[model samples]
Target: MTAEFHVFTCLSDNIGVLMRDTTTGACASIDAPEEGPILAALEETGWQLTDILVTHKHLDHVAGVAPLKERFGARVVAPAREAEFVPQADLLVNEGDRVMVGTLASDVIFTPGHTAGHIVFHFDGAKALFAGDTLFALGCGRLLEGTPADMWHSLQKLAALPDDTLVFCGHEYTLSNARFALAADPDNQALKLRAAVVEGQRADGQLTIPSRLQDEKATNPFLRADRPELARSVKLDGRDPVAVFAALREWKNSF
Candidate 1:
């Protein structure tokens, strides 16, 4: 059976998502950004969180995990590479490992950029992906612990997924991402148009997330580093995609 996903916000901009398999009523909480929101969502939905999927050991992502685990006995799954930083990880997974959420199985994708052990959960069967900080709506995660090439390679892996994939990222920074995207790829009409929509959404107190891969492929400057328009906008026309990507990341850091 397909997994049902309930997405909500917690903390400042962190996005909290819960996946429940209707067939067996097994539920998974993608990340515990805060105990209040996670527990509230469970109570509101009346769904017990049976598993906790930690993308990385970032404080915002794991701070409330132990409480939720204690409260609901939810099994914790985290990257084996950085289990020391993650609390109470019952299952240590790496790239290509598959974890079952009741009857549904999600493929593990190792995307090291924001952190060395960051990973994403992709349920191809359900066309849903929990990207964490690796990939966002119109931007990719900031390269903190990893190099630009490492981040680029990781993003390339995600960009290759089916275009219909619904990417649930870790934060709500799409409005700012859209603005910077325009400067990075000024000639992109699609991006300009999307930025307008994003502005309106934020003004109305709406969430502009769970972006489709196809739209990102077309308008996301980071993902379109190989495209000539992006290279030209950065005045590095005909440059290698990796080089362009590196420059773009640095530019966005200050943007």
Candidate 2:
């Protein structure tokens, strides 16, 4: 049986995701952004909450972990590097570790940029990535606790994933990310088309999470930092891609 997913909004713009293995009826929440929405989704899908997989120590992502665990006796799986922050974690994982939600297994990849210990869960069999704040639809996470180089390297790991992979990020920042993308790569036809689509989607009160990695590779400015066009866009045509990435990140900070 295939893995199933349910995406919903929680706590303003935060995106809450629930994954389940159909064969064994095992369910896991990507991050417990809020308790009510998670409980509502569980009730809607009738999937038992068995696990809480945490990507980072951000409060918005983990605020509901304790409460939900208290309610369901769910196991909390979190990053080992930030174990102190997630005191409820039952399993602490690092890079290359595999976490199993019933029969579905996800490879743990440490993507430390948004936070020093941030990680993304990649379910290779399902071709899905649960990228907390490491990456977004048209943008990436702000370098709050890591350097631009750290973020750039972290993005590279994500960019190398299979094109067909589906990316479920942590927030609903696609429209704004699209606007910034268009400004950074004004001549990108693909980005222009995507921006228009995002605008229409938002205008119709739609959610734009779970974007395809293929589309993101083709249009996301942050992922295209190594390209010459992005280099020139930042007026650093001959600089290294890391430098280009740094410039783009700085511009995006205030965009």
Candidate 3:
């Protein structure tokens, strides 16, 4: 009984992932930015959604929860720490908690940086993670509710995953992020080449996301902020990992 997974992009720049058990037909929707796209995706796949796995409380992530719940009677599972934001969680989960959609089991990794209660769902066997606004393909989310240290730890956690892990982030900010990455890490030949590739993709109206963790490790500036080249470019005197992280984030806020 192999687990099946499908990713449907929603909103202007958001993703909604569908995970299912091929045998039991149980399915889970990872975040609902909008109803129309989610409904259409489910219909197209002929999936019966049994769960709504929310990553955070941001409207862009959970705005369609009510409608989806009303339509499919799906149980809402969210981080217990974010109960105030996700008040109606039917199942309150915490770090290391596991949720299932039939044979597809996802281990919850609490990553509170983009949001204080944010958590990314990692299906280790599947090599997939539903990282909503914490880590992007070539970038990381802005520090909205959490501090730089919080985001740093969260990113570190995600970075420790298998290099082949497919990172499904929240938005299509890759191309723009690559441009910034070049500015911050000019000596990175791989990042420069990636920027060119991403530019071509963007020019052709393509979406650059769901990037492999390995690619991100090489090209994502947020992840490479510790590199000597990036550290020097950011002009942080200390060269500490935390200091480098802070410089990269500050530069991104304006980028």
Candidate 4:
């Protein structure tokens, strides 16, 4: 029962991840940011595309859905709310839905706010999470289609996942994310130390992503909505968790 997940960068900074069952050669694409890199990855691994799991309706995330679906004749599975924006779907699922690929079964987590229909695919047994734009490495997606309250609740859902979950998000925004992270939580020793390490990675032109959920809980301001230090920095009038989250997100956007 050997199962492995392969992750690759596609387009400019988007991610295309494939979870595979080694014995069955079955695979599923987390997002369709681009066709070339994903096609190449599939070719190299000799895995059959079983399903296309779309998190949201962002162009960078679903632009290649049409071509990829045409080529592989794979079924499109997306959040029920964004089914209209995504390419034709064979299944429209919401939170708590389960998607299977060979021996792997993933729980569909609805984590909106980045987009009205954003969702995450969590393989509980594998300790992996394909969290599109909802949750990033050391940051989170901007509040585009949802409000601060919406995003705050959405982030809390991801935070509740197991600490060891290996988060695979949509874009490669860790470096810039770390910059804002530093400004928002300068006293956080973990973030301060990681900022330097992230700088070194960027200096070498390397990608800094797939951060552990545990690390994000410690550093990501969005996920730390309850931290008293962050609450002070944001200066929320009340002890409202949502207010703290909103303030932190606003500060990060300007940062």
Best by TM-score: 2
Q: Model 2 Cα displacement at 127 (Å)?
A: 1.1
Best by lDDT: 2
Local accuracy of candidate 4 as per-residue lDDT tens digits, 1-255: 556777789988898888887767777898899889999998888888878888999889888889989999988889899988984788899989998877878899887788888888988887888999999988889999999888888888889999998999998889999998888788999999888988998899777767899999998888887888878888764588888988888888888
Off by over 4 Å in 3: none
lDDT of 2: 0.95
Q: Local distance difference test, per candidate?
A: 0.91, 0.95, 0.86, 0.86
The 10-residue segment with the lowest total lDDT in model 3: 1-10
Q: 43 in model 3: Cα distance from truth in Å? A: 1.8
**Steric overlap count per candidate:** 0, 0, 0, 0
lDDT of 3 at 182: 84
Please write out the lDDT profile of model 1 over residues 1-255, one tens digit for every residue. 888888889999999999999999999999889999988898999998899999998999999888988888899999998899875999999999999999889999999989998999999887889999999999999998998889989999999999999999999999999989998888788899889999999899988878899999888999999998878877899899988898999999998
- What tens digits encode model 2's per-residue C-alpha lDDT throughout 92-159? 99999999999899999999889999999999888899999999999999998999899999999999
Stretches off by above 4 angstroms in model 2 are: none
Instruction: Rank the models by TM-score, top first.
Output: 2, 1, 4, 3
lDDT of 3 at 26: 87
